[model samples]
Target chain A: MIEVKNLSKTFTSHVKEPGLKGSIKSLFSRELVTKDALKPVNLNIEQGEIVGLIGANGAGKTTLIKILAGIVHPTAGEAKILGYTPWERANEYRRQMALIMGQKNQVWWDLPALDSFILLKEIYQIPDAQYKYNIEFLAEILMVKDQLKTQVRKLSLGERMKIELMAALLHNPKVIFLDEPTIGLDISAQKAVRGFLRQYQKEFKPMTILTSHYMEDIKELCPRIVIIKSGEFVYDGSLSDVQKMMGDEKVLSVTTQNGVFKVSVPRQDLAKKTHELFEEHYVLDLNIQDPSIEDVIESIMKNGIGAT
Target chain B: MKWWKDVMGMELRKILAYRSDFWITFLGQTFIQLMVARALWQAIFETQGVSEMQGFTLEMMGLYYLIAPIGMKILNGPNFGFLAQEIYDGTFTRYLLYPLSVFQYKTLTYLTYSLFYSLQMIILLGIYRLFISEVAFTSVDVGHLFLGLLLFIIGAIAYCMMGMMIEMIALWADNIWSLAVMLRFFTSFFGGALIPITFLPVWAQNILVWTPFPYLLSLPIRTIMGLSTFQEVTQGALILMLWTLIFMEGVKLVWKKGQFKYTGVGI
Candidate 1:
């Protein structure tokens, strides 16, 4: 189980003005500014559960992940993962946890992925049987067995990401923190990664916290979602609960001979609105659907938690 | 021990990835420096019309120049900017996540490079002894050689810690490259890689002896060449060890404080 209480992170940086004159002046006297990257937030995640963190850029998603992963120190609050404080960086705790960042790679670029895996095996001290089995199983599932022998720098982005996933999962961590793991991949590659992750989670039953911009990833993999805005958690619940909180609204789209119209209406008024649109124009096609997860998230991001 | 061996193997593979590049750079730099030293020293000797200066004959000076570079190379180890660059780019996050000590890993990497250069030095020395005539030192004393090897290892480790100490400044400084370059220059000049310490004035030599620079290159070469006594090498070892301890402490303190400042994002 992961328990976080009043966790926060604040970054302080010096402000520099533009131009040579300002640069020289600031060297003698400068102003410092502080920004709260993460506010005091509380969260609890249980084993075998995958929680999706939804937020816009600079919304503290990554900061929260970094804090929990022990990569960054929190300004305030306490967090216990599997009964261990992460920032202390105990070996037993680190051994059972894995942090994978999509934008950054941990593999050595100049060497084959297998070489890096060997080094990791030594670092983690996995038994021969377990290490060999994991290597085979992860390679087969991710479908990058051939590419493992190639240099990481030589592999395509998709292949490299697969190798990275395999590397992170080699120890079969009990807790996984994935930060935009599918970013910058093609649609097919994205699907492949999602499929692999889903299977891995099912087999290992590790607690996973994933943050991504792709709604499909959340919709397909996560049963629970948390929305963060400006360094705070605005809403935390299942997708259906959030949709219901939007007050029984449905999106209506009508394509007529002249043009296509799309709008949102309350569920009770959906039928009347569709009929009125059909009567007003020569409708070739019409459809009524629930508001997209993307729309709901965008609205929540723009407004406060009560916007739903 | 097995883990260290595996890591060392990986480091070796990385070094061998571009064989031609490594060979060209290593050999080219060594020979070019030797050539320049040879030209300058020959001119000085000819103009002075003397067979010897500062207790070093022309042959001894040539041998000194040849061995000094290898000694310095062994001490310098691999690139020290690795940690600083990783900190600047936010890639240092990986080290935090790994269940191993970053300092230990870096020290091992440095040792691997130093060991490889030591091997080159050995092979070069053997070749020179076998092929060249008029070798300056005819006989090798096993005791002196052993002492020299010990001091070489200590000096290399000391230099590694010093490099890391400079690199930890990346936690606050925007750029550490200039500082690193400055360290390299100071080590080469003060350590007597550029010119023999014996050629310097007595006052300058006395001042440098108290510093860690001479143990890094000059003293080690002189010890191996059978010019320095066992007592002198022992004293130098003690001083280098003290310096290494200081650097180790500085690195630890910086790392402890720097963790709070790290945002895990590129600066």
Candidate 2:
């Protein structure tokens, strides 16, 4: 289980001036600027639930994940994963959780991926039989069993990412924080990751919070979605609810003799509007469809979530 | 204990994997430096018409240069620049997420490096004994040798702590390469890796005697050469231990504050 309340982070940086005179002046009178990466937010994730966290760049998605991962201390509020404060970085808390930053590697570059797993095995103090069983099971599920002996640097991006997942999951963490776990991979690799993650959720039922730029990943893996805007959560509900909240209007595409005409109308008024259109013109084809989740998220991002 | 052993083993494997760098740095560079140093000392002794300089015989000076590299290698271990680079690049997040302490992990990595360098030094020494007729530690004092080994271990740890503290400044500065170079220069000059501390002016020697740099490499070399009295060895050991404690405490404070300042940007 994961719980976050009023969790926020602000970064302060020095405002340095250019040129020698400005540099000299800054020594005595430097300006400091603060940027809020996360506004106060609250959330609760139940065990085995895969929560997709979506936001544009600088939307505090990664910041929130880092705080919960205990890699970055929050500026305000508290986050508890399995009842332990993350920032305390208690060993027991660490042992029960795993954080994977897709852009960065957790495996050793020069050594075989298996070597890194063995090192993790020791670090977590896992029993030999359990460790062996977990590695074999994870590798088989991820279809990276043979590639485990290859030097990590020599593996393809997809292969390396699979090994990274294995390395993180070797101890069978109770909670997993994944930040863009499929960021740079190709399509098949992305699908493979999503498949493995979905299966992992089904089998182990660990609480997982994932942030990814890929919309399809969210659509495929996350049944529940949390949409954040400008460091605050704008929407938190089922994926379908996001589509509905984007608006009750469904797009209507009518293929007339002249051309295809698209118009948006409220779902409740769709039948009447289509009937009137049919009366006024010759309709070759008519299609009514709700907006995609991607469209809903894009709308929320462009024109604050409240407008949706 | 298993974790520590595993960490050290992992580091050793990493070091061994980079065979080219290991051979070039440990064998090539050290061999060239030793040969050049021996030639320079040979020229000075042959031309000066003096048997000894600053209480060092030509043979002793030759042996000092030979052993000084090994001593400096042990004292400095590997540069902590990688630690600084890790902080700057955000790769350190890996350690942050792990259950193990980063300090202990890094210390073990450096210890493995030092151990590997010690092995290389032993091989070099064996080669020297095989090919050359010259005897290095002719007047071996077992008690002093034991004391010197203990001091050497403490001094190596003190240097590691010092390097880590310096590298932690990378959390604030973008380029710590210049700072690291400055540290190396200061340590090599005062630690007598460049020249015997006795060759310096008496006041300079007195000033350095109170600092930790000399104890890092110079005192250990002197103790092994049977040049230090029992009282001086005891005093140096205590001072080295004190310096180790101070640097370790500084590391804790600096690392704690540095983590707060960490932006985790590079990755």
Question: Could you say which candidate leads in TM-score?
Answer: 1
RMSD of 1: 2.7
TM-score of each: 0.93, 0.91
- Model 1, residue B179: distance off in Å is 1.6
Which residue segments of model 1 deviate by more than 4 Å?
A19-25, A252-262, A268-288, B132-134, B139-146
DockQ class, candidate 2:
medium
Best by DockQ, which number? 2
lDDT of 2 by residue, A188-301 (tens): 999999999988888888899999999988999899999898899988889878877747888788999999977768788989999999999999999988777776788787
- Give the best candidate by lDDT: 1
Clashes of 1: 0
Q: Residues A1-308, candidate 1, lDDT per residue (tens digit)?
A: 99999999898889888999889999799999999989999999999999999999999999999989988889999999999999889888888999988888988999999999999998888889999999999999889989989989999999999998988999999999999989999999999999999999999999999999999889989999999999999988898777777668888878887888778888888879888887888889988888877878888998977765
Tens digits of lDDT, candidate 1, B162-249: 9888888888875699998889888989998999878788999889877899888888888877888778888899999999999999
Model 1: what TM-score for its first chain? 0.91
Candidate 1 has a TM-score of 0.93
